[model samples]
Target: MVVPEPGLPAAVTIYEVGPRDGLQNEQGIIPTATKAAFVRRLLAAGLPIVEATSFVHPRWVPQLADAADLMTALRAELGDAAAELPVLVPNERGLDRAVELGLRHVAVFASATDTFAERNLNRTVDSQFEMFAPTVDRALAQGMDVRGYVSMCFGDPWEGAVPIDQVVAVGTRLLDLGVGQLSLGDTIGVATAGHVRALVAAFAAAGIGPERLALHFHDTYGQALTNVHAGLQAGVTTYDASAGGLGGCPYAHSATGNLATEDLVWFLTGLGIEHGVDLTAVAATSRWMAAELGRPSPSAVVRALTPPTE
Candidate 1:
């Protein structure tokens, strides 16, 4: 039983990333219908924001190659509810694809470390900004809300222990480019509670308020939840989580599952915070997704709460 921290917000907004980030890293290709169904389930479970797909070149993220088809299907099925979907766009071309599909929300990803930028995007950190600038600008100009993702903000697989100032600098650039919110990712899940507090403090000191920041933690070291608790204490009200704890970075081989939505919901509920997510529905979705992946869920909450079959 966890006690509610006095400074924590009464409510938090969870940005569900399972559809894009989670399935992108899977070994097996999930059918387009299944992916679409997954998104519907997540919405039905009450997640306000769901990352639907990435428009990166198919050669890069083959799992989400069906971005167009998936979005088309979802737009048709969800109608007005489709407004909640956000797709990841790598550049002008990706953004064009998203725009063509009538997407109102999009996300652009960047890394705080040069090595990761080179390996992941085949460009230096600065070059990535140049590549992403036009997309960010165009998206915002078109009246679409943009979200920025700063990968390896806590620690990089190649560089290790990225400076908080460096992350802040990159994040500030993203904000300057007109991203409504910036999600700081502990890409390899190396952050502790202390690190989370310090990083949030640094960002706050730099004039970026908690309202403009979100935390995305991987559960590689079993510290995702602890860091989330610390994030709550720091007044960050937005977080990125995956259902069924699905997903890991293909570039960062050692990285593992993302912080599970179920686990975070359990923590938030125990702390008496209002997240507007149904724990049982999310757990059932996790169980169903785990079955799709042919594995047990990595989330402890899902495991313990899931009922046995007769």
Candidate 2:
């Protein structure tokens, strides 16, 4: 008898967050020119979904201070492709900005952990949703694509352990708010394969499933690959990854970062799954970005496959 593979599919859509999520955490201000070019290159690599930028307060996130400028530039530069660029709006104000700029897809964020809620959003976990209620309503009313983020699904930096019920309740509320999809995030990368399996099972029991959910994970402790395997086994096909493993949770301290898109593509490719992304180009771009940041490439595959410059 032959053993069949796991939830390996013929194709997958990678929502690229490197421009917003990846660059937001960098210590310095990335030049607007470089940021725009990054988007151009990533889109050129055949990535269908690329999160362009966040229209948030510069005081809260200085790195994205050029959000407006970047948004305008990407749209003008990409033209028709600009339709695929989605911006993140943390609240009503941010959403307003995105709408004014004529963006069709936008993301709203929340946390499932009390500790992160207080530190990150300066409100209780539930209150953050309340704050976002009006914006979500406005977005749905305007016929926009809304993606809800439920962060800290696996663990928390301050709270240490997070409850499964909290995640379900928060996710359920987001769904009730009419979110087209819920992206469960393991913010600090402390999640194990067993925990991944359990949480997906819990979400399933609570009326959430792969068809309406996405998984975002950080590779801080090196369990990201295994977590991907687990998410697939749980029937999830959509996953979020950064280029070259380039992002980390801002609310998370001493953590590594997001699962590299290149790594995810490599894994899927090995499984004979079509990710519709150019892995070779992804590796080159990862190397370039790592060089500009003056840091070691976090992606092991990139380090091995990319030829060394003399």
Candidate 3:
């Protein structure tokens, strides 16, 4: 039932964020070995860029406390390929650890609203950039590719509706600070398809084209896939999704798991778009991981495609 959509990109890059963002807020500490295995499974399933883990402090995200250990295991398991995995480096200390490990790709988290910035980063919206500037500069000097994540792009729990111009301002500052790409986060999944188009248009108007942007949507309100369709129509070719729909904002309790990678694959497959992911394999991997986590996958595609038990 493949149908080609007019004006959509023939190919899209699925930036897999399951390992880091997906597991960051989990209740239990997934063993480093299990985390490594999960990442390996996703890569084997044809995920192009699997974000492996975060270098953020263990206190803030206890689930990924073994970030270094996971990276070490991945390096031993995947060798040179492990260097291509992306990790979140929240500050200079995190960057130092990443540099020490010879990691090549890193991402920084930021918030569009001042309230969220203070809650998440303990800094105001403007000051978060000051903190990220040095980290971005150092990472770039060390030959690392940096991706900036602007959360609360659509709306905020504390601040309610966020202005489009405010989102643009935060995103542009990250770009100005030398981030190679921007991942606009609908952190609480409150965005509609129209909001998606308007935000993309706003970014484009600010001279940041779709080529330099990626959409990261949460499925809290069940609008994730809808927003993705609008992103595609607006010429966005990169998306951030989690396998098995496993992730939520730790700072924002209302935010649910991300748009599932399996669901994204299904939607893209139906549209005859090229993402190079094996839908069956991803579903299988998610099923396995869900068993390990002692929960059912929240992804509709995974639930529909996978057997009741494996």
Candidate 4:
């Protein structure tokens, strides 16, 4: 039997980002039907919270251009489970689209550094707040729970090694805008365990508890799991991960795959943390998704557990 680790939450919430963040970076545009089926499979695998799709303009992210179609199909297929789905909204327009679809939850993204903000959103860091404020306020007023994603919280490809204070400031602004949760992203995966601890400590010092924060790390330098360990040690209970590790930032060219869902589930299981996610089911889903994407599973745990076909 596994033993509970000190300073870790008895249960953790795994925010599955495969259908949205994972497939969004793929070169091929996944069909809306395929994407909807993928979301169903993830829900069947016991993921309570799954990012469904992004409402970004097709010119920017053509892969998820069928966001509306996907949402429609998911609502029809998943029924009440559809309530757990959250879509990404880039602006008020995106939020409007989400509201039209009857979405009750949405996520808005901002970057820690000016370079990333300018490149990713075509706005400066400060301007990003201006862009997001009205959207966040509108969403909250509509009774929609908003989530804030702070990208490049650890390191930016253009601007390396972001300062903790800068990340905290952006996070504070997001929270002030009434976002219920903030997900700190290691976009280029330059975070270490120490960085995770320091960032969480800084946020805590600013009165933002770990309960309101989620950690999203990529495995570019192979430190994603280590950073997750640090986050758990620091009392963070929510984490964002992709099945089969299927994502990279198109804007951040050097970014690798996200922290794999299978890998994180394995770690959580060993730590005696109750995540309510089935590791075997997630591994199977990862393998299936890798086949759909025409790539091998990027998750080490999935590869180890899944037998190869002759």
Candidate 5:
């Protein structure tokens, strides 16, 4: 006796964060120029917001040892791109590198679950937020857009279940610090539909309206799209997805890819929602990326688009 998924707004925005989140976790470090091509292809394919790289120290994330170089190359190639390519900046040093290169947008992250904060960022809750404050101020002062990410909003891999208030308190601080969007991440893909509804409701009651939120769900347990429905029902219109379910949380052991962007678009369109993205082209783009990455794609849309075997 459950209700059908509620209708979404006439239009919704999908921010693609695959390049930064998806590629960073790979054990092999993709070449700098190769990373540039990933950004170029996604931008050419017309993704609205592509998180290009992270400015963490090379020792921390050797995968992005060439963050500055990638930016220089991508920025030059922005000539025909229809989207914004931003980087992830976790603190002052990371943000400083971004500012030095005249970057316009960057994302910062924290965890609703304290265990993740320590495991992921190796800092306590308050210390991590403090690390972000000056970076937020500098980015705002420089007229850059900031997207704040809260990992494990629904449940944590190590911490069992995160309290709703902790999610709200951290999210509010980021929003208060001038983040244009707060992306709630089901980092471990452990959220059920019921869990999704409860957390979104809790966020709403905390005076943090739906407009400022986006859901970033992982598909580890195969219930991500169902959780997306629950998220839509709770009034969140924006979503963060990867082109071919290409991203995962590095800190979450055994956590799998995100809800595929093409799958999300397909789901929304089938339900008569308007997302203004070209699904056919996106599927093609996913195929291209999968080929480049030398891996089989996890996206259902790409699978559907694959030619039938003889």
Candidate 6:
């Protein structure tokens, strides 16, 4: 079943986000030790780039209240590899924490629509960059590469269909602010495959090729995998996925868990695309994490291959 695809890139970089984005929205707090183990398992399974944790204020995401502690544990366990892990830094304060930990890679969250910006960031869409500007500057000053996440690129629950132009506008502003890459987010998962291609095309027209972009999709409406296919055809080589499908927007109630890493690996493997992830190991890890959370994994590949135990 290893069929090679014609148009897709030979290799893709799976930006694993489970440790950070996946656990942030959990109702119960996961221990720092458990979180560190999750990252270690992922790295052992051949995930090239795993996002470690977020530095946002604990008041906002209590589940990741131990961000600093988790990073410390990861450093002790993984050593130099820990610094290669990416962390989400919401603003200057978060970036400061990352700097103190000697972390080198970081990401900042941005919103495409005004409503989501107000709710998630407490600033207007245009003004949100003002908040990110200094943080991006300081991170760059310290020789860190910052990835920008543009949420609600496809559709917003409050604003309905987001215009392609508006999404590009917000994305380019982040690029202007010096983010090395931008991850387009389908936050509520309302996008269709056609919409996904259109948005990617729009960015391409703006001189933002797939080389500078990553796709982040949710499975709220079950369009996540389909959109990934579109991204592949459109030449996107980087994707953001969660393990066990374990993530949703803490701010957007309508949003659901992200596209599962196991599922993405299965898809890539079937197409003969050289994604460096080990699918069997990822599924096993997801099952282990699901056991810790006392739930079944939502990934179709994980569920089909590793049946739930009694």
**Best by the TM-score measure:** 3
The candidate maximizing lDDT is 3
Q: Candidates sorted by TM-score, descending order?
A: 3, 6, 4, 1, 2, 5
Local distance difference test scores for all models: 0.91, 0.85, 0.95, 0.92, 0.82, 0.93
**Which runs of model 5 end up more than 4 angstroms from their true locations?**
1-6, 80-83
lDDT of 6 at 107: 94
**Which segments of candidate 4 are over 4 A away from where they belong?**
none
What TM-score would each prediction reach against the true structure?
Answer: 0.98, 0.96, 0.99, 0.98, 0.93, 0.98
Q: List the residue pairs that clash in candidate 1.
A: none
Q: What is the lDDT of residue 304 in candidate 2?
A: 80
> Over 4 Å off in model 6, which ranges?
307-310
- Tens-digit lDDT track of model 3 for 1-310: 9999999999999999999989999998889999999999999999999999998888888998899999988999999889999999999999998998889999999999999999889999999988999999999999999999999999999989999999999999999999999999999999999999999999999999999999999999899999999999999999999999999999999889999999999999999999999999999999999999999999999999976555
Model 3 stretches astray by more than 4 angstroms = 308-310
Tens digits of per-residue lDDT for model 5, 200-278: 7777888778888899999999998898888887888888888889878777876789889889888887777777778
Candidate 2 is scored at a TM of 0.96
Native-to-model Cα distance after best TM-score fit, residue 152 in candidate 4, in Å: 0.7
Write candidate 2's Cα lDDT for 1-310 as tens digits. Answer: 2233755655667888899998888888899989998898898888888898888788878899999889888878977567558888988999888888778898988889878888778889878988788989998888889999988998887888798888889999988998898999999899999998888899899877777878898998899999998888888888998899988866677556789999988887777766799988978888888888998788888888878671
* Residue 52, model 2: Cα distance from true site in angstroms: 1.3
Give the distance in Å from residue 214's predicted Cα in candidate 5 to where it truly belongs. 0.8
Q: Which pairs clash inside model 5? A: none
Q: Give me the overall lDDT of model 1.
A: 0.91
Give the per-residue lDDT digits (tens) of candidate 4, residues 1-310.
6877787889999999988889888888777888888888888899989999999999999999999989988889878667559999999999999999889999999999999899889999999989999999999989999999999999887777899999999999999999999999999999999999999999999999999999999999999999999999999999999998999887888888999999999999998999898888888888887888887898999989987670
Model 4 TM: 0.98
